[model samples]
Target: MTDTLLKTPLYQAHVDAGAKMVPFAGYDMPVQYGLGVKKEHLHTRDNAGLFDVSHMGQLRLKGANAAAALEALVPVDIIDLPAGQQRYAFFTNEQGGIMDDLMVANLGDHLFVVVNAACKEQDITHLQANLPEDVTLEVITDRALLALQGPKASSVLSRLAPQVADMVFMQVDNVSLMGVDCIVSRSGYTGEDGYEISVPQDKALELANALTAEDEVEWIGLGARDSLRLECGLCLYGHDLDTETTPVESSLLWGISKVRRQDGARPGGFPGADIIFEQIATKAISKKRVGLIGQTKAPVREGAKLFDADNNEIGVVTSGTAGPNAGKPVSMGYVKPEFAALESEVFAEVRGKMLAMTVSKMPFVPQRYYRG
Candidate 1:
């Protein structure tokens, strides 16, 4: 009954299915359904799990200057994207800090963008206020998002729509399914070979019902979603990334396009171009966000202190959890570059005791993306 709670289109469905709802990013989203997080996590890894992500924000950019205007906002080379291709980019602030990360899909003549639910409103405002006069931003709230993720996701989806089997990772296409037009993209945050489907608001339920009718597909809630992304080394917005973090320090420099890092000629004229460009030139970052696996039962949560062997606090935990796949307490946080090397030993302060930790290579679980 809180006035601040926003509801996704499948809110009623979740309620009817006995989901335990909680407030997240202003939405009354299901934390876990009748199945617990552990069960849901295993189900998604073995078979197919459907997640209602309609709370995520989708938008379209149109006009002759659409690509150019978008390029100005992020470090990615959006202007160079080919038709029907999708590229991941970041939204930066004036001080070279990342405001949010987004996916930009070049749908032929125009651009389709998907941003996190927590950042949609601000992202839209930023685009509207900063984009060139020739470009126009259109919010696509009339659509719904569904993610079918797992080893069997492709099989289930292909059965529903044959053309989906031909789609490669990060590639998107418009196709008709069950008499409804839908946009399907072979991409997901769970490190599984999956697809994200965008459908008309009215037809969303019908499409979801059809997909769930398959024996391989089960409904998944947000509880397992977090653990899945964590095991995959994907950063969560407010926890691991924020307006205070930059793409470079966050190990997201790959998202920065080479053309954007050219000599005096910056690719785009967005905020903090100078600082971002300078970092590209120096290649010397002050701190780095890296992954760590510890040998202790005490779970390190966000804001936990990261200390060197001598107990000197070096950084803080951005995100931490008991990785279901890793079967251990794995975490990510920012640390001084010197202590961020692979195999470097460190400690996480749990209460008053220091738990042993080491800087390890991330993606504790291997990614199963089908690029070919």
Candidate 2:
């Protein structure tokens, strides 16, 4: 690690656990630990895995008009977002392209926003420049974020704070865990029942230690994190999504709330609303994101050019991985509209060999979020 790389609150803990550190988003983060990536990935699927995600940006938006002010920047319905609930959203440009995806939680008195680590400064600037003067944007730098995920996540966390057991997916609350006041949310990047806890910087290591001490929980690193999210069919901001890719093209139309659509009650007030609405109305998108499952054992990786049976280049893979739980190589990529249909056969060029891939539905592994 270099002097310029920043370290999260759990840096020492990761180092002590024999984590192989690497630079990510300007932070010295752990890529894997003593367990290695494959085992860590399997452990999380079978039991529980604790991850240090404190490097991501967290901000608070305060004011009565905070929700309305925020609605103008994204295509989601912020005004109707219920208290103690969170929604997935993204920043869009005038061309209807996604800038960055984020999580917006309605925390009653204010809104708590968590953005991608790499786009922190840019997202902050975007919010500052567009939000009205009444909406106060407060950057949260004194907290550390931790994600405890897996089938046993709820049981492990509920042991510390029993009240969290009642919170379902997308629910957020301020709770006390081991005497530390923390923001707890029933959400995670992995398609598993999990809780994302934001603790004070000073208490982060303690909380992490307590979680890992559980028999079911082990410290996971960035390598497993990426594979987990990839298996979940989640988009990595700069990879699966980018400024030139609109939400429509990224297969993220579900993220746009119905109320913000052209025919909804309040519509067309957001940036690129016209373009998005037109795309929805006309279905004129040239390309779209689709899931690819490899027919052979070879892993089809990102940036691999996809082709049709006619040997014409159709698209490029945006994210790919060998899904441990799915027992196959899975990937997601953009393809011409005609090649984006389910069951459509496509080919990915890897090592000068054309690998057979099939367009399939995402979330290769079932999402095990706790709904009740």
- The candidate maximizing lDDT is 2
Deviating ranges (above 4 Å) for candidate 2? none
lDDT (10s digit) by residue, model 1, range 1-372: 646798878888888878899888889988898889988988998898999998899999999989988998898888878887798898999989999999999988789999999999999999988988889899997899999999999999998788888888999988788888888889998888999999998998888888888999889989899888888899999889999877878998778887887542456477888787777678677889999888886667788999998889898888887877788888999999899999998898887889988898989889888898
The reply for model 1, stretches above 4 Å from the true place, is 263-268
Q: At residue 121, give the lDDT of candidate 1.
A: 96
RMSD of each: 1.6, 0.8
What is the C-alpha lDDT profile of model 2 across 1-372, one tens digit per residue? 458999999999999999999999999999999999999999999999999999999999999999999999999999999999999999999999999999999989999999999999999999999999999999999999999999999999999999999999999999999999999999999999999999999999988989899999999999999999999999999999998988889999999988888888888788888998888878899889999999999989899999999899999999889989889999999999989889999999999999999999999999999999
Minimal lDDT window, size 10, model 2 = 262-271
| Model 1: worst 10 consecutive residues (lDDT sum) | 261-270
TM-score of each: 0.96, 0.99
Clashing pairs in 2: none
lDDT of each: 0.87, 0.94
Say which candidate scores most in TM-score. Answer: 2
Kindly report which residue pairs in candidate 1 clash with one another.
none
